[model samples]
Target: MRPRHPRDVLVGYDGSDNARLALQEAIFIAQTSNARMTVVSVVPDVAATINAVWLAGGDPAQLSREMRIEVAATLEEAIEQIPEDVPVTKVLGQGHAGPVLVEQIDRIGCDLVVVGTRGRGAMRALLLGSVTEYLVRHSSVPVVVVPPPERLRDDLA
Candidate 1:
């Protein structure tokens, strides 16, 4: 049985192909139910060094600026894909992906959180702990994980 009536819905859109698929589902539910929709993009906190070398020659500010600009552009592209009839607020959450998603859901009082995943095997998911798996277990609110398009097609077949 599917759940009915989502009040405030949040979608974690990282501009990935799977995320775009998730956004489509989110838009449908939000539009049909007239629920408030928020599209969230989570960016990892800036790290200047990978090993001994600095990302931008030890310039954290420059690295931060560049990442933000790229992320913003991706966010805008995602926004453009959204229908104007369905209102969606864009939000940029900073931190690790999983925690940022959980935090935004709580801060925005979102009852439903939609996310996208590659839908890897159980062993791989347990070993790597993908964000979808993390959110599914960690989030106090409801989490709906939308798998990649091919996975959905295969499931239908």
Candidate 2:
């Protein structure tokens, strides 16, 4: 069976292995389907009071700048993997992960969205919630959830 082609595809990237796989899949789909791709990374915003409390001695401005730099690097790595023939755009967003992704989906008018899920980290979940789950439930467009690589899967026999 053939999968439907997406006109404009949006992928959420975080520089994780799962995200790398998702980017690879999205690129292949974009290439075969003659679709354009957009890659987005989120730089979560911590409130000033929270930063002062949790960050302690860390400089807020420096931390924000570093986050932007990391986001740019992630985009650059994804861009390098993409074939030259495929049309692609990159965006670095600020704020919470789920809402930012949802906002980008609407703002970009993408027909499809791709995201990657990570291992269950209780601390991470308690802090950031689940972006993948939120997108699967709330996104107006279709979504593809890419799991960890085969080598990383412990269930395979």
Q: List where candidate 1 sits over 4 angstroms from the true fold.
A: 1-3, 48-58, 119-129, 151-157
Question: Which stretch of 10 consecutive residues in model 1 shows the poorest summed lDDT?
Answer: 47-56
* Model 1 per-residue lDDT tens digits across residues 1-157: 9767888888887788888988888988888988888888876775534322363356566667777788778778778877887777888877788888888888888889888776445455433227887888888888887767785444333
Candidate 2 residue spans exceeding 4 A from truth: 1-4, 48-55, 121-129, 155-157
Question: Over the stretch 43-69, how does candidate 2's per-residue lDDT look in tens digits?
Answer: 878677456855587677777787779
Q: Any idea what lDDT model 2 has?
A: 0.82
Q: Model 2: how large is the Cα RMSD against the reference? A: 3.9
Superposed Cα deviation of residue 35, candidate 1 (Å): 1.2
TM-score of each: 0.81, 0.84
lDDT of 1: 0.77
Per-residue error at 13 for model 2, in Å?
0.7
**lDDT (Cα atoms) of all candidates against the true structure:** 0.77, 0.82
